[model samples]
Target: MRKKRIIKPLMTRLFREPHFEEMTNEDEMDLKKQDISRSYHQNLETFKSIYSIPKNTDIKLREFTVRSLNRRAFIIYIGTMVDIKNIQEGIVEKLIQSQQPSSKIQDIVSYPIEKTASNIGDIIGFINGGITALFVDGDSTCYLFETTKTRGRSIEKSINEVLVKGAKEAFNEKVIDNIALIRKKIKNENLIVESQTITKRSKNDIFLVYQKDLVNNELLQEVKDRLDSIDSDKVLELSILEQYLEERPKSLFPTILYTERPDRAAAFIEEGHVVLLMPNSPSCLVLPATFWALMHSPEDHYMRVPYGNFIRLLRFLAVFVAAFTSAIYIAITNYHVGMIPPDLLMAIAGTRERVPFPSIVEILMMELAFELIREAGLRVPSPIGPTIGIVGALILGQAAVQANIISPIVIIVIAVSGLSSFIIADVSMNFAIRLTRFLFIFSAGFLGIYGASALFIVGLFYLVSLKSFGTPYFAPMTPYNFSAKDLLIRHVPIKEKLRPGYLKPKDMVRQRKG
Candidate 1:
């Protein structure tokens, strides 16, 4: 009926050839796109242009002919990035001696030397990655051979996290070797390893490893999301990634854990946590770390239950002495002299009679000097490191006391505090302890025992409020769970039948009664 209103369609060109301008623009766009050229010469020219082969002497492009078929081909690779022996024996020798010139690339390259990549970007990436690319005259694709040359230390004893009874092996700079070390410890098929390039310039590789069946899906997803959110051009070490992944960058207490031993990393992976590794990093990062976990050591599990509990109790006492000793000294002298025994007070007063500065100033001066000596010892060569500590502490303390700059009691207090810090096995927690000790010292200097007590309460509150990847940092203790027995005390291994309940692991039962 509306055919009466059959007006001619305004834009009725249903089929027509594309305009010359449109076709030309499309062609130009295709040319600008990065893709491998079918022409061998074109591809070669592209590589030379991108890599500046003529000016960059490290890039070696060798052209040759297949002797049997008289076909042309070329191989491009970075000389320093690849092993010369492997290039000669594995690639060059095999290519020259091959009689099947017309065979498929796979057959030509052989197993373990797979061929991959046809795009220009990928080809260049492979070349820079120490892989050799062979471009045949008639083939449209390029063949890549793996010849990466990674230089690192052989498996060595753990340097930082020493253990009395455990494997001596530690992770090295080579990530592949580290993965092998982990796989050797964990032979289960569920140990999943996923890797991705985190930086564009260096193309640094980062690996996330965990148990597939044992890991919590949400925890794994959170880790992956945090990793993906990093948009930096360079991440050289796991420490940098740790900083990026940490929720509270400004907090003195670390939420993530770092360890150099593979056995410890494997143990964390088995506990439904994730482990991260990168090249040039001799340690791995363990996520969702708890206070109790950081305080425990591998040697604890190795010892008998009673002996382990004794060591744990001693460590607890040491932490208290390290953190509160100096603050208590300052507090007692400045605010609570009556709290000290009369004879001891008289001796302390006599010792400080000639000192020129107040208790706070004397304590800070010695603490600052000790920190400087510690830093210098760390920076100096191993041969002289211990010497620096002994000379700097003993000689300097004697000189300070003799000069009447600081009393003898101040030196003893600082030394004891420094020594007690070493009992905490985890370096991160030790650092936190050191920082908290300073805070306590200042608090005591200002308000004596009252100030120290208040600050201690506030610090406890902060610890309880903090979360590491959705898990409470100070769990099992603050939340009043039955699991507090394992917090500061080491129970018999047979009596502990469950994993940490706060983690909400998919598999919670660690063991069963005999």
Candidate 2:
């Protein structure tokens, strides 16, 4: 027998596959090397093979004969997503009538052809929207004929963020559709959308929306840098993306603003903030957002200027009341009875006497009950949600007070606080209100309203210190940007000329009063 030669193998390490294409020239003898074109083709076929596009799918695949060109062509489209009559005139008629003068794709010139499309994916993209790609048999080049979908929802009032007066249309999940909506308002070249692939496996779409002139260059760089730093395998939702880009990840207050309304998003884009739109989510994020920005609704700008201002002022007051009402009630009854109105105090004390629980216990129980009802209303179906909100809150509060487990005074205070909390349009800010409520309640129990007042002062200082992309959270107050609040609190349309002072605003005035 011949002596066996034992060759110790090098490079034995094996690991997970990288999603990116690796350009390498190693020969087939080395199994570690890969061919990009071949690999891409394989991946395409594999993906196509595995995908179960339902038969109900309207996207049609038709192969037609081009007699003039004497070549066969394939048409991929969804009927509702395009104007069929245009296709007949612009594509089919031209293809059938025109004679082929050249064999090369580069030499053929008769009509506009979309060049951005490179492969099967590009073909799929055109099929889903305006522009249908015609792949001629034996020719690698494709013609993208314009045939964008038009039959869809007209701009209507948004159901969520229901503005008793603002623009109703919300941004839909479709990326291009959302982009068009924003374009309707900001008809400027400066408005830009920077595309990014959020998912490696599915290639989820993410757009960084901003007006180039107004947005902070440093903040914009930071946004891109954070996104680039992500080494994750997938990015399926907005919450995940927010955590990566946000400056303070663990903080209770939301550093980014999320909205479903297209107008709201468009307004933010014009105000020197950066908006991000996701592929399939209607709710996209607006970055470098201030604390005041969240409390506002587009209606605050849309309604009569005086009405809008009054509502804004009311909201400002409501926030303070909702955050401190219960604590004030606790402090007055338990510690500072002298500060309370004599008759009212006597009546409150009378109600408290029947309750088995102490003032703190009673208040906590009522607050917890209100939260439970709110949770139940949210989780339930929309049709019945309002009913639950009404029945659960009214019936449960009344029953609790009647049972004497919680006092009637507790019920009244909780009701006012809950309703007041809802006055602020943004959901993220309510967390602050909720947090402050508890702190105030505890402080009143421990050292009366004096402790609560001190806590409020600290809270104000903290809010002043917090920054979003270098723009102070309390604009016009802490950072003292006069140009900010005119638009922020809602103003006379003709007079409000300047943009918000934030995110390193490139322009202060959008229009000048002559």
Candidate 3:
């Protein structure tokens, strides 16, 4: 039996109206934590108690003077980020040079960030912004001297979301800068940035940005609930955090879309989907992303409807060509010889008659060569990279065909397949295309076009069956959305008024009804 020991006299001495036990327990926990943290520092108990920095770094910031705050106070901040000059000119100079004010450390001193930074959390943020931290001999609280130097990548076209013509500005590493860019575009008070600090890294800043009135409250609440539930040790970037947070990260198709362009992210917010902005990460994530969403690009809006639709449709065709080109060639050559045109068939036969490998083996060999060239080109420096890829592919591909190790037809097919693979902006989709292309080849080899067709149908079914954040992976197309204008054809922007029903998102209406 558990004994209930009541502290009757102890409760009365502690000046509290009620709930003395709970308060005592909480205080004990806090003291215990402080003791444990202090003990971890060993000889450096004074410095470690304040910042709680791990014991590994061995360097105790030799630049600054460390005085025991027996006088028990110490301040810590990254050296490069903190403005030493500002600290000397503003905080330390002002404090030490002046006639002493009230003895209590709580004297409301006049400082820029200090007004909001009495606590350790606020001060830490202030220092991270390049402000220096100031330590008084004995005070428990630390003051961050604002001295963060201007440092970050200039806003430019993001490497991933490269656009021929769209907003030139892409998100830089700074969270505030990125948000400011978007806020400048919308200029609405209703735009809400619901911030969260994940338990993983207490310092990580996450913003769930959406148009307040436009976004349903329930949706916002759900976003908050899920964010609260996320528990991890450390989150360095938004992509890593997203994998853990999203409903179907294991799925091959990406349900969450991240773009460096604020214009695109802002548009998603306007349509009432949640956009998560993470600190130290330039790319912002859009939830409930669909397959068609990956296919669409920001330039789709910049160009006139007909041109946009034509380009999008072209992209759709390009995907098929990339995926099925080699497979179809292998199938037709090895299994369905009758399907090939008579003249072309004769030409292919003449070319391959000299080659010894089976059509499948030849196709796979060429594809592997192309992939190797592509990968090597990407891995090296950009200046030499593209040149190496072009020279390497041209030389190797030509030499392979001449040597009779691979057929000329296989060379052309592999080249086209590799070229088409790069057309899709999303790398993951490219991988999917690359994988499916080989499947198509095997299908054609085994059962010709019939097998290829059946495999494609089955693959498409799995694609449609997949969901991103509970939204249909192939909506408006698979379910046959009546408003196919935006999905396949780009009607004049005005005609494509309503938002896509793919997400069945909280806000359905897009453009204001006339």
Candidate 4:
């Protein structure tokens, strides 16, 4: 009977369903949902349990007596996230040495009280955000102090969006600094910076920056609705939040433009576009991005009108060259050889005499090689990366040509195509153009110029139908809205005075007619 009883208990213990985890989660949730208790001991015990005291070494719970009010109190904060000097000198020392007998808790602390909260959940949030929460004996409300010591890099020059003549400062990983940078540019009362906690567990804050008087109500509400609808436990950065906010997640072309330049973001905000900024992301996302906006550079507006227009024209041509150079080469050589001049045609034929592969195959091999070199250069260490790229391309191209693996003209075609892609400023647009180039190459190989043209028309149709937060992708040009004629070439600042009409901004005129 003893043996049987022991075996039965052992079997039950071994095969029992695991509910401890579920039960623990439920209890934690209940604790988080509870309000702060009037009894200081109860609050202290609750916080200790929630933070797993003794086990969680980084969470500091310092208990002290406020001599002024003759009340016992404790402050809870994450040790690594807060400043120890401020807590010791400003909060604890000031409260202990105060002589005001009837003074409130806020009066005793030397640090300014940021806010007060009664719910356990809010206090936890405050603690997590690097804020110090003070719970007093008789007071139910917990006082919060701003003692966050977030570490981030100082403002540095823009790396990706380098400009010869513009604001050189780029945003760092701090959202508060980014907002200050924008505020420095625009000192208007109407400029608004509204924040919303998007995630449930992480409580990541996303800032919506816009000119309140100029921004469309419907557009702002739409952005808010999308942000509020995010059902994730954590959305840590603007890059991740961008995926959640975009209308079409699978679309090849990016609807929003991401820029690290605070000046660029500020310019967009002044023009009635909404900018999304989040902590840890060194860039801000500009919404309702049009093709023109993606293609434009800050240097365009900084330079003289003629110079800006000249560069803009070159960039516009470069886009086509990058997307069509290799594809056109394949089409002409394989299917439209008759169009070539006799001398040129004979020269081309002579170069390819030793080449065994078809023109399509030859071009594909070169394109792939170029892409590999570019990606390798980006991924490798900065010091040796450029050297590797230059030497690798030189050696690889020379070897291929000498061995007659690829024709010499194939090298020229790939080089020009790759170089032209760099003129595009926006990373997402650069990727879109590069990927579409491959599609054109495939189409051209199959049906020559006709296939390429057909694909181009379909792409145009797609762009026309696409919308970023209700603004057309090809706005002010395709839809013929009344705005500055800045599509292919931007006019001088004096002449370009109206905000984009597609945004339907509350105020249409940027400057009054003189």
Candidate 5:
């Protein structure tokens, strides 16, 4: 008996699935690798099989005879994605009504053909991007027509980065419109918008907007290399792509500046900075961001020198108040009560006489409550959000004081800290400040003033050491590069002449020395 005595299991079958699994994967790969056929019938059937036509209702395939040429033709597109009017009027109607027998397909069609593709893979990509593809009998190439339906809200006023003196318009979700907005600001021929496909599977495109004449080639290539190195199958937004491009993902401080204002993006481009734009993201990413950039508002430059500098000073003060108020209170009350005047000390002691918790515990409890109120304010419905925040804080604080769970002085400390944090407009910087506030509070609790001071020094060192795309985080300030002195304050617009020296821009002079 040949094999009846001992039938052993195959190692391949025992370790994995049958060989048919490999064949199935190869078949799927072959579908994508196949070339477009010259025969209209064969191309039609292949697409139908690949897209699973009957099972997939949205993949529309319309077959018809081109009466003018006396040839068979077909158009395929996503039903929901393409414009029905463009398909019916621009393509089908124009193709069938052609009077000249010698007319080419491009000449006969009323709509402009965007591109022609001979590969099945490229043709499918065009169709998937809301484009209509036309194939005729005996023709290997497919004509692509742009029939993508524009679906998004119209441009609206700036909401998050609201400015009283600057442009009221903000970027919408449409990338074309966003590009248009930037173009509207910078009409120079050197303003280049280069597009690249960064992902493998999803094929999402990112537009890099910069002035070719001004942007340093090395810097631009470095940015391009980082973007090209992303191996993700899908990256849907600029926000998600920002994380991929960031060198320090876990750092509390943001290395990129995100802005919804096209004017801001345009200004950065003028300064030889690269601005990244993507679809579905209302904001654009400005790379090689500095600490001052994140802290700045567009309105700072929009206003007069004195007014702008005044607000800047206030904002500067607010940052410290927000980050240090709770920690200072914790340090003084817990470890060094002598720092307070006699009257203030007696008042604080009197307020805490009825309270049962230590200074740190009381401050932490109030801070947690304030954070909860602020978070709830953001998450609740728009109509009732402010109401919930106001009423919730009032009731919670009053009840806590009445119940002797927290001191009135601690409430004042936490309230000042919370209010100061709101003065910071940038969301990322605000979060970093608030989080650092907690760290300082814990440090001060452990070792009083010395701990907070030590933490501050360490943080300063970290900030100075951090780099965004090879540019120092605290550039044009520490390790001093010649800038317009626009870091903490603003000079008159006419006096501000230099592009940031640390950027090492190709053109250092913004406005030639007048």
Candidate 6:
């Protein structure tokens, strides 16, 4: 019979709270130098200790043998992270059924990603990435198989930036699936997708995707240098990386574009823009965003030239209304009242005869109420979101008007301005427009038309000064680049034979006469 040996006193003496001050530099170095042992048993024990295997129910370690080679082997993998079907059919079944003795590792696994891991760090990395590790009893090396099985939502229509015509599918949370979508769109050999590890602790994979031939060497080098300089321990999402990657982090306008649709990202890649793809993020980042790119939508490409131009014009007008309508109304009411027709002036005066507050105060109050309603609608569940907006707007506006707290005309102006803001497709740019609107409103309140006009001119100067990755933010408009066409106007598809000359692409001519 085996004897039970109790060493409670020994255990008490050996295990205790660590004292950091007592540890020497050499001891710290020794701790850091720990590596995988050559013996299979030692390596297995190390993994168990590291993962707390017996305590951790999710980690499964199965011991088996290659009967053909007469060697003992064990498979260590996370049950939830790996594909069970692949492990069963690809590894276990094949190994069990092979009658012929095989000494080569390639005979066992035909996985394109099969790799030999020598150290504990490599083994841990492979296991963490949802790969199964095969540790043989005699050999010092271990084999890794990519059996990752990540669950994600199926491709669905884009909730934001929706279109009546164009690709319906948006990017999901899976990075591999996103890359596959891009590859499917652009099958050219020059479409390069390079994987890079950003964070040391998490070892998050970030992909730099771009066309090798079309991408400018300087811009590519700059991107690489910036990525290389990131010294973060963990980057949880792509947006976090974006903040670090941005040239002017505090700028009001977004220097880089973010897109949820694969078609949009692929189109930008074809235009010589480098896209940064991060794991777990549904959106991809497009570098060096231009003013035109921000305003352009996928629907523009789907429609014919004239129709597209018409839509673009309407969108521009919507932006004008969103940003300047309230400000212009305030300016005209306060200082430029002469500009209004006598009939309209008499009607406005008659409506405001009941209200005691100034025009600016009433307008601001209604705008704030509208913003609150917008927030409440956005925060509620999908089915009830729109319902909340409609009910709240109707009740609140009616009540405020009945109480004479705000003028009916003020409500109309605020509602129209808020509605116009929704026409903007890009979320970041839309937010910028909203912020700029607030500035214009305040300016209009102070000095009427003069304040608003001065602020507008200053904003234009600031925009012209800003650059996105060495490309001017205003681009062809400010610098007067001749080769680039279709600014504020959409030309026929065939007429645009050259790429944007301001971008300085290697091959400018997109189409030749031949």
- lDDT (10s digit) by residue, model 2, range 18-122: 321231223112322221122322333222222222343665555566765566665666777787877777776766666766564334434456563545454
TM-score for all predictions? 0.90, 0.77, 0.81, 0.95, 0.94, 0.91
5 or 6: which has the higher TM-score? Answer: 5
lDDT of 1 by residue, 1-514 (tens): 3321221110111112223222343333333344564666666655665565587899999887765456677889999878878777776666667787556545554425566677666677678778889887777778888888877799899988887776889999988899999999999999999987777666777899998887889988998889888888799999888899999989988889988989889988877888999988999999889888888887777788877888888888999999999999999999999999999999999999999999999989998898899889989999999999999899999999999999999999999999899899888889999989999999999999999999999998899888899888877676655432577777787777776777667887777673
- List the lowest-lDDT window of 10 residues for candidate 4: 14-23
TM-score of predicted model 5? 0.94
Query: Best by lDDT, which number?
Result: 4
Better of 2 and 3 by lDDT: 2
CA lDDT of each prediction against the hidden true structure: 0.81, 0.70, 0.69, 0.89, 0.87, 0.81
Error of 3 at 18 (Å): 42
Instruction: List candidate 5 stretches off by more than 4 Å.
Output: 1-25
Winning candidate number (TM-score)? 4
Better of 5 and 6 by lDDT: 5
Residue-by-residue lDDT tens digits, candidate 4, 62-146: 8989998888999999998888899889999998898877668766777999999998888898899899999899997999999
Instruction: Write candidate 5's Cα lDDT for 145-212 as tens digits.
Output: 99998689899998888888988999999898999999999999999999998997788989999998
- Look at candidate 5 and give me any clashing residue pairs: none
- lDDT for residue 474 in candidate 3, whole number 0-100: 80
* Prediction 6 TM-score vs. true: 0.91
Q: How many backbone clashes does candidate 1 have?
A: 0
Question: By TM-score, is 2 or 6 better?
Answer: 6
Q: Which ten residues in a row have the lowest lDDT in candidate 2?
A: 1-10
Q: What does the lDDT read for residue 406 in candidate 2?
A: 80
Q: How far out, in Å, is residue 268 in model 1?
A: 0.5
